[model samples]
Target chain A: MTSSFTRLLVMVQKELLELVRSLKLLWVPLVFVLLGVMQPASMYYMPLILEKAGNITEGAVIEIPQPLGSEVLAQTLQQFGTLGLLVLVLVGMSSVSGERNSGAASLILVKPIAVFSFTASKWTALLLLAWGSLSAGYLASWYYTGLLFGDVQASKVLGSLLVFGLWLSFAMTLTLFFSTLLRSSAAAAFSTLGTAAALSLLAGLLPKKLGWLPGSLSSFAYQTAVSDIANVSLFGWALACTFTLMAAALTGASWLLRRSSAID
Target chain B: MYDNFDFGQILPIIAPILTIQLVLVIIALVMCIKAEQTRGPKWMWVLIILFVNLIGPITFFIFGRRNER
Candidate 1:
């Protein structure tokens, strides 16, 4: 067991080194920070933008109400949900399948490392990237929102970050699972994004029935940030479902990779 | 409200966003140039990254490269 743990750690280190070398460690989070700041900055300057771009006649009145800080933060999370999730999925889509397709996995698998450790390492690296980028983006949004709007409770900010991070985790895990199962990275990305979109749509259309679904994690995060009162029970269930799904996906990827490695 | 378009006040607020965006575009451009190969024409990616705002550079970054190792 100790040996396995050490193996996992060594694999994770290798994965992190690869991430840094590829410059994903830098660019992904930078993209997230940009997305995060855009929400609040655009919101704060919407009227000005409209005036300048729309060429509204002087004395023409525009009455867009200023959004609350929490709402601004929530909107930032929304940005992360869509474009941010897409970027992460694209970055991670090739995690396993790319290696296998390029014959890199065969080289590594011939070594003494366990397949579980390999999958676990990839999953951990992806998680670190996802969580790090999300947190940085969320914190930037919170800071800008506070500066431009009003103060939001730090507790609420942290709570929303936790929930939204879980949603991103599920997306990344789905990408990883598909990468392991499929030989083509593009197919893996497309399928994962499609599944995420469908799940999000279902959760949106049937909020009451699908409130506990992993897709609703984003909504839960939004509500937690924007409202003083949130449905804790639903949030709890969503959290539970997300973690369970993530675990299942990780194990499934390991199993699939083991079979693929054996075949190779 | 029209008078409130003070560049001094606005620049401070909007500067960080523009800077971040510029950095992203620059990074994407540098990568595109240095990349051994990309998915589409190199000129097309340069145009997209230069003109298409946030999503363009990101698209180029995520999907542009054929070989990312």
Candidate 2:
């Protein structure tokens, strides 16, 4: 047991080192930070932008009200949900298939490490990147929102960050699962993204029945950010579902990779 | 229109975005030049890394590299 744990650790370190060497560790967070920053900055300048673009009468005035701090932060969360999610999925799309294509997976599978540990290590490394990038981007956005739009409660920010990070983890686990299942990285990325979008859409379309789905975590996160009172029970259920889904995806990936490594 | 738009406040707010973009461009360019095999011609990637703003570097990172593990 101890040896397996150590193997997992070593694999995690290797995965993280690859991330660092590829410059993903640097650029992904920067891109997310840019996404985060754009929200409040663009919202702050919306009136000016409208004034510059819109053809108005001489005496017309732009009466758009400034967004509240919480709203700006929520907008940042939405940005993270879309473009940030895309960046993360793209970054991790090649984690398994790329190694397989390069014959690295075959070489690594010959070692004493268990396939579960191998997949777990990849999940761990990607989770670290996802959570780290999310925190950096959210905090930077929080700072800018505070700077430009006043301050949101720290508790709200922390709560929403945790909830949103779970949503991202759910999406990333799906990416890893697809990466292991499919040979083509583009197909893996597309399927993972399509699944996530469809799930979110379904949850949106039927909120009452599908409230416990992992996709609801995004809405729970938004509520945690902007609303004073959130549905605690719903959030708990969504959290539990997301955790289950992530665990299932990881196990499935490990199983698939274990069976297919020899073929690859 | 003679207006009271202060560039000073906006400068501090917007500078980081510009700086991050510049840094990404530079880093992507350097990596492209150093990489032994990229998906396309080196000169094309150099042009993309130089011309496109935020997306150029990211595209190069994702699709441009060959045999990245």
Instruction: Output the number of the lDDT-best candidate.
Output: 2
Q: Which lDDT tens digits does candidate 1 get at residues A1-264?
A: 999999899999999998897778888998899889888988888887898898788878989998899999998999999989989999999999888877889899999999999998999999999999999999988899999899999999998898889889899999999999988899999999999998898888998889888998888888889884367777778778888998998899998888767554
Question: For model 1, what is the alpha-carbon lDDT of residue A6?
Answer: 95
Q: Scoring each candidate complex against the real one, what DockQ results?
A: 0.65, 0.63
The residue pairs in collision within model 1 are: none
| Residue A98 alpha-carbon offset, candidate 2, angstroms | 0.8
Candidate 2 residue-wise lDDT, A74-98, digit = tens:
8899999999999899989988998
Q: In angstroms, give how far residue A202 of model 2 lies from its true place.
A: 0.7
Task: For model 2, name the residue pairs that clash.
Answer: none
TM-score, candidate 1, is: 0.94
Model 2 chain A weakest 10-residue run by lDDT = A228-237
